[model samples]
Target: MSSSNARTQERELTFEEVDAQIQNADLSEFENQDDANAQSLDLAAQLKKVCSVYKVVKPILSLVGNAPFLPSSWKSAVKTFNSVMSTICV
Candidate 1:
């Protein structure tokens, strides 16, 4: 076989090995359901922190976006940002 063809075949084998590893990956792996439950609680606490920050910021953003004489673009951007933040709270 030509050198280029041989090199391509070798690369294919390496890619297949990496693919197998990816196929076996477990994103939320744990030893047992009890461990998974612990992880869930940790994530819930983190989400609560985000919700607290959102509660504090939402009112300020609303006031800025609603103020008279502000540039329309700035108001629109703030409105979009507020909507996005609201979705992440829960």
Candidate 2:
């Protein structure tokens, strides 16, 4: 009835049309072994990078572990380091 109401109705209809198109579209093109393997390799590379960083930081973490609550100035850093270590250990 009003201009605002008409605009709202038009927007709702546009969304419904888009949703219907997406629901009816074919997705068979993405179902391939090569695609799956590529995704797996990418994930493995990312995990390797994380593991490398952890290895480099692990000794520093162990040194910190020897001093859990050294001083107030270092408490925040120590707490954060310990928290991260605990999370990694779990």
Candidate 3:
């Protein structure tokens, strides 16, 4: 094999070994209930922000009655925004 090809293979093997070590490590040794609770609280705060936005926008959308296209667009926009927020919360 060429030197570049050999180097690439060596790097791949090294990465695989590191990944295996990480996967096999006893993660529970580093786990902490307090840390988990703090993360949960942070996520709750983000969810509250999304809920507030939904409440504020829904009333505006309701006022735009009889405008089928506009309402459909607003619905789609809200769905997309909520999906993005949910992904970040996770």
lDDT of 2 by residue, 1-90 (tens): 568645743432343544554566554433353846646667657565445455344444445544546765575676577567546543
Structural similarity to truth (TM-score) of each candidate: 0.46, 0.32, 0.28
Clash numbers, per candidate = 0, 0, 0
RMSD of 1: 18.5
Model with the higher TM-score, candidate 2 or 3 = 2
Sort the candidates on lDDT, descending order. 1, 2, 3
Question: Can you write out model 3's per-residue Cα lDDT over 39-76, one digit (the tens) per residue?
Answer: 66676674765454443333333234224566677767
Segments in model 1 whose C-alpha atoms lie over 4 Å from true places: 1-45
Q: What local lDDT does model 3 show for residue 69?
A: 60
Q: Judged by lDDT relative to the true structure, which candidate is superior, 1 or 2?
A: 1
In model 2, the runs with Cα more than 4 Å from the true position are: 1-41, 68-90
* Model 1: colliding residue pairs: none
Better of 1 and 3 by TM-score: 1
Better of 1 and 3 by lDDT: 1
- The lDDT of each candidate is 0.62, 0.51, 0.49
List all candidate RMSDs to the true structure. 18.5, 20.1, 17.8
As for candidate 2, its clashing pairs are: none
- lDDT top scorer: 1
